[model samples]
Target: MVFKCPFTMDCAGSVTSSCLVAEPLRSTGGREMLRVHFTAEDLTRIRIRAHPHPLWEVLLSLHLLQTRRGAAIFGPWRRDVRAALHPSGDILTTLAPPKGYSPDFLTPFVDSPELDDGLEVVLSTSSATLRADMTRLAEQTKLPSWAWRIAGGDAEMMRRLADRIRQYHAQALLPYAHVFKSHIREDWARRAEMAMTHGLEHVLSTLHPSIRWRAPVLEVDYPVDQDLSLDGRGLVLVPSFFCWQTSMTFADPALRPVLVYPVDPVIGWASHASATPDARSLEALLGRTRATVLRVIAEKPYLNTKQLARATGTTPSGASQHAAVLRDAGLVNTQRRNNSVVHSLSKRGAMLLDKPALQDRAGYPDIRLSNPSAG
Candidate 1:
């Protein structure tokens, strides 16, 4: 069986079609794909991460920094991160090479999506696991003496590696969290809505062009021929901002099953400095605070008064007032969920954020946030 993309690649190796990234379509034949076998019970068990996984982002973004594969998309962010990197960033780049095996211990599962939790897990990696993973990595690429110490489960080496990972995350990933994370949140919202309205099957089938749902199996574009049996453990679909071109799974099948797939590609959102310009433009139209409120709502829909206030750095009453004004203007919708008022962007509001020009074209009402009496 063969899978083909409808788009053609241009001289720059970019897809002419707006729908997909180039790599998946670059070579359709003789490409390896992962076939995930699922049982009926497993179907019910499939889940999606609510937010970006910090360690996963750390690993994948490091991969991007070392390679020029997705320059069209990751170029700006790469340049910015490189400028901000400490000399210690080399430790990460060395551990996670661009085109080969990376020690699985670098990205261990954390109970929560928080970076601190993930870092704790990394620091606590079992001695046997570290030696085994480093041994596997050694087979493919040369490791430095420091890396060998890590394999030996030397505490100081392990701590140094964790510290470097933390530094890289803070330098490269944290600053741009709003842009990429907002995109991931949007992806999650869409997936959740699809699951609720159509069914889980629809969500899986439409995940990406490179991933297809065929009855009991999910075929994914991958670097190697592999099969994962869900055997009722279910699978977590993690939408990643730094993961480019294709979806990937754990090299060690014994770990919990996960599919880290790239989210929908939006060119402007890919840049590290994009959020500032976009926010500035919106601030020019909407007052700074109100615009921030709208963006926060868009990122995490169904935010309650308290959560919204916390996110936007405003008081609860202030958040309520802004939400009320947006609600009155038909730009936001409010509903009672679990006895708390939650806010989300209405269709018109989403359109405005997605295409700023649409507000002019649609002739949305002039919203004045300067009025002291108005929210």
Candidate 2:
């Protein structure tokens, strides 16, 4: 059965199309592109999320980590979180598709923008939405026994699922709350600056190296033949710290469209080797200034020499020299972006932070990662 488009007024006579799927991309040169055909309304509605959406992040984490794509970017987070999650990790894995679709109801956008409020709203998902979402999910995957039980709208099942999400958040994400929020705020600031200074087109064009802003359509690289006709319903662009490699969109064409893209350099859970002696983390190991450079790179992950210099209050040459040292030590990784190079932390660098020898006293070894939808 075809579900009516949510934006019936704007997307007149629109119906969900089979072609609306976002196929996975081989992503050569970080170049998987999705050509999002945006209408004028979408342009007006184009805005950055003020805060991270809980459902999106939680659910996306499950999907990415399960697929092992998360290992590269989320090396530190994954290693640390896994030990804490235990049996909950197994339960969480069921809800998210390692590679395909998830039901829309599982990640309902809460009425409020706040994470707590949103999670509460998620807990209170309407029966109609749950049935619809679960039914859809059922169509795609051979869901486990637990999912079949929840499809009946059982209160006990629902409560258990919600509890798992709460537990998962506390275990996996809470520890990084401050750093994650800080990175998001920084991203929002940079986006706002770009929007104000460079115009919306630049904002789209520079969204990621893989994304290309061609007039009327935002092209994303992917492996299969797929297309998303936004019609007039504006899209929600959600930046995610855990979303790796590929940008994800909602599978159900009937729901409000969303694009969950990875936040650059958002993961650097590891410590870097500093020029300073025997210090555990990059900052302490490298001395204040050098560590600041690594931190800056982690916050922005994938910056050119000039951008790095400006952010770290160092000359481009100085940033270049420090980056080289970090790279030689296998702490930082660099990629070529045309004439310039982009720098970020290597998986090895993130692991350095995870080691007991370089452990931070305050960092929590709490919570295993879980997927709420799995239950």
Candidate 3:
């Protein structure tokens, strides 16, 4: 289908009907859209976020895992994240709603960022602010037993809460947080280049499946049906690795407008899982047992946990445990099919399997045609 660039705005040159970003159309159903009306000032003020928000990603990831909405994509980190949250009790998990009111203080929009910076914002919130946030959250659903203590301005509890935030980040996010931000930068660079070359029209039209550029209005695919008028505040389009859904904005509509959208396929591919090593690399780096496991996976692609275990002479759980390590290193890629999850070599894994051959192929011959003196 052809997308027409709205003529009212200046795009210098026209855009082809083709999509510039690949993940948008695939990510959404295009059933319902957020019809966001833009004021003239909103146009100039509109921005694309250059990096992923550290706290937001953690909150979002925790939300998904608890609800199991996007659990398949998370891999073994599902278990690890829960363990990380254990120190905090059930309170941390309750803050990130799949939708509706979350305690704003806990997951505040980072007008300023950095995990500690945002946590400080949460911790430093006035008594009134904390009470208000807790009250709002309580109305939404049942909060945990200790919720009142934090809301009541218990300093010791708040200190412990901050530490919990640190622990949570370490477990769920530290492994891949920088990579997530880096991928966002990489994607934003492409969008920035496109906007520079083709103008903002191209940026909006192909922004995502859920978002559309229709002349004066910026359409977003939201859960509930409503129209949001930008009212000259403009929008911050934040690209996130952990934001698996269509897009979201700050709860406080009065706050500066922002839209948290998932990054494109490149970011998704980069952020989802890393590659696992092959037999040869394992032998050199780890041990012969690891090498043997790699060889078993290499011999057969898409081996389910049981098959992999049987082949490697280990239990299914053991095979999965090893595969998790390999997956993190950027060697193996795993997918779920029906009741089973299948694991196989990634491109990096393939290279690991045949690195010497690749090196030989890449080697260019320096042909020593007879040097006259030498001859």
- Top-scoring candidate (lDDT): 1
lDDT of 1 by residue, 25-131 (tens): 33245666778988777776777776788888888888778767567778777876676566777778777876556777887766466565787888888999999
TM-score: model 1 vs. ground truth: 0.67
Global lDDT of each model?
0.70, 0.60, 0.59
RMSD of 1: 13.9
Candidate no. 3 TM-score: 0.60
Could you tell me every candidate's TM-score relative to the true structure? 0.67, 0.62, 0.60
Clashes of 1: 0
User: What's the C-alpha lDDT at position 152 in model 3?
Assistant: 87
User: lDDT tens string, model 3, 198-279?
Assistant: 6767777777776888878877765434466888777777777776545666544555666777774342442343333322
lDDT of 2 by residue, 1-375 (tens): 112111111123221222223444443455434567887666766656656677777787676455444454566666656744535665567666665456666666543333445656666777777777777766656788888667777888876776676556654664454456556667777777777666777777776775777777887644333467778776677776666546666656667777666676533542221212223333346765565566555545677988677555567899899999889988888889999999986777666543222223232211111111222
Clash count, one per candidate: 0, 20, 9
* Model 3 lowest lDDT segment of ten: 1-10
For model 1, the stretches where C-alpha displacement exceeds 4 angstroms are: 1-30, 270-375
